[model samples]
Target: MDISLWDQLQSMDKPQTTLNNSVDRVSDEAIERYARSKWLRHKVDDYIKDDKFRRKSVEAFHADLQKLSNNDAKSLLHVSNILDNRSLENIGLDSGDYRNLLITYLQSRQDPLSTYRELILYKIHNVLPEEYLGWFKDDLRCSLFLAYLVKDSIFINAYKGREELISVVTDYLRYEIHMFIEEYTQNLPAYKVDYKGVGEHKTVDILYAKSVYLKNRSKEKDLKWLDSSNQHQIDWTYNYLNEEKRSYIILEDIFFPQTKEEKYELIIASLDILSNVEGTDVESLAILKKRKGDTKIISRGNSERIDVIQRMKKAWVQLGTDTKNSKDKLVLNITNKNKEKLVALAKNVNQTPNKFINQAIEDVHREVFKIDG
Candidate 1:
């Protein structure tokens, strides 16, 4: 007799009989297993009746399957069969494809379209087994799947539209270009040139030039806050300098300005914005303009030749003064090995160790607070 039917018979009112003994002899483990099987079947039936619940059940199963280890082969095979029956190929993935695709996607930086496709495949793979296994409730599973679809669509459309993609790519490239410029400027050779006809011309590194220009052109109130707009302008200036011809001329002028001033002027003229925050040197602009009309005036040994160096020195002093007056100081006890490292880094950037330390503190403060001065 069927175990459930026997169980039912035992529950019915009846006189004591030998059959009762057989019913009572059934193992507790078997009865428990039967009860669990019935409960699971009922849940599955209910899930099938509701379209929304059915979809969620499948999504939950796939999510759980992603987190499973190799030890879960039996469960994995079961889920695979359900997915296969539901025509998994329609979404361009099969039972065994999800894990490998996800792993590849994580490791690769392929084009946006391919990445979006991989993401969609991963989300939609193997939906039926989860439903049968009751892995996630209807609402949560639907929500997670819907959310993934929406996000994936945005990325897909962004790529197709091109404008958004260009903007994102430009921002990323801008950051990389700015970083290279910063390093390049900080480590420029401090070479001096003495032309036979022209008086001695002192070379000003890019960072020093920028700092001096920013200080002299802007008011104290303007310099008090280096906000997002200021930072964007700074980034744009660095990116502009990253152009091959512009960078070459700038470096040549820094080393041999007496001979290369014309080339430098041409590069500087390419810059579109010339406001205070953009750090355009008005004196340099005026000199260049005058030289355009009569080259001999600029070619002659003029006091303006040394003005940039003097401005740079003044900027350094201002930085030190501001750091000293603005805040309380903290003393740190560091190991000699670390001290040696710091000293080496300071030397590389032509900074005193104390000034380097202050610069590092300021950098950290900006990172933590998202504010700058």
Candidate 2:
């Protein structure tokens, strides 16, 4: 909250904020601009360090803003006018940058068309109500910081009223944060996958962008980056949970089927403990573009004529009884006479009957080498 910005809001007499009539609230645009100009990056290091100066700065800010009445929209937007040498960029309000802490703190004005006025009439007038106000004293610079308290609370919405305004502030915050990160660079790797243990017991894990992490020290392991469009993903991270061993992981963003009936079978086949996948709801069958010959599939989820779907199910059943694989492991406890339908159901969508039989083998091949259907 720049004191000058606060001063501009005071003149609007927005809704509530007002100060004691006894206090001298001066709308001296030149003086407020002069104060803002003094706290450039080089000057900021000193003000935040000194207690007396910080207090004096904020109080002076409050006083200067208190000057103008609620008819100062013109002055509020054109802060550049009062100061001859300072530009908006020169008035930095970055996370950990305290130049405009006072102004950003002001948020929406009580009488916004005017200055940094307090609500004299409201039941919650005077000092910032404890519940509504929060303060952060952090050195960890992040985009979240850039948007609101540190930047603009306009980006994140904890509730409905706050939620609606999030995008407006978030866009501005994104540009500012990106510029900040570019300026103060920290090279972080995106989307990593690590494997641990052996065979069926081995697990593949996932992570988003982690600001705080460590590298695997053991020379035996190397990082594999799986990049599509999103680079900010953290694919691998050291897991302290299992012990001293570091782990590699991959992010698999698979949306789950929405209907309970639809989800029960497909989700079971697709997800496993070691498979790094996530999901929320069901996917309606896609309006699939064809591979030209697959014109029948375009009509319905069911395969027609000789019934490709029915044949695939029959194949899976034969294979499950004869072959040993992961999917078969899931059905192990089910009495053979009880879940014949589920077994048949899984078989039906197993990508054709021969494919249904060789499915686990194909998965094995994929793990050994990067192959996709």
Cα RMSDs of all predictions?
A: 28.6, 23.3
The local distance difference test score of each candidate is: 0.35, 0.29
TM-scores of the models, in the order given: 0.15, 0.17
What are the per-residue Cα lDDT tens digits for candidate 1 across 30-119?
322322233333333443354443223222323433553431222223234343454323222354555544433323332322332232
TM-score of 2: 0.17
- Can you tell me which runs of candidate 1 are displaced by over 4 Å? 1-165, 168-272, 275-373
Q: Given candidate 1, what's the lDDT at residue 304?
A: 32
Backbone clash tally for model 2?
A: 50
Model 2 per-residue lDDT tens digits across residues 1-373: 5465345434443333243322222225433332223223223333335443322323555555444332122223223222223445433233333323334434444423223222111111211122211121121112222222222222232322222223323333222333333322122211113223231111111011211211211111111221222222211111111123411111112222233322222212111112111111112112111121122222333222113223433554565466666555543355676457555755778655344546756788998898877
Instruction: Please name the candidate that would achieve the greatest TM-score relative to the true structure.
Output: 2
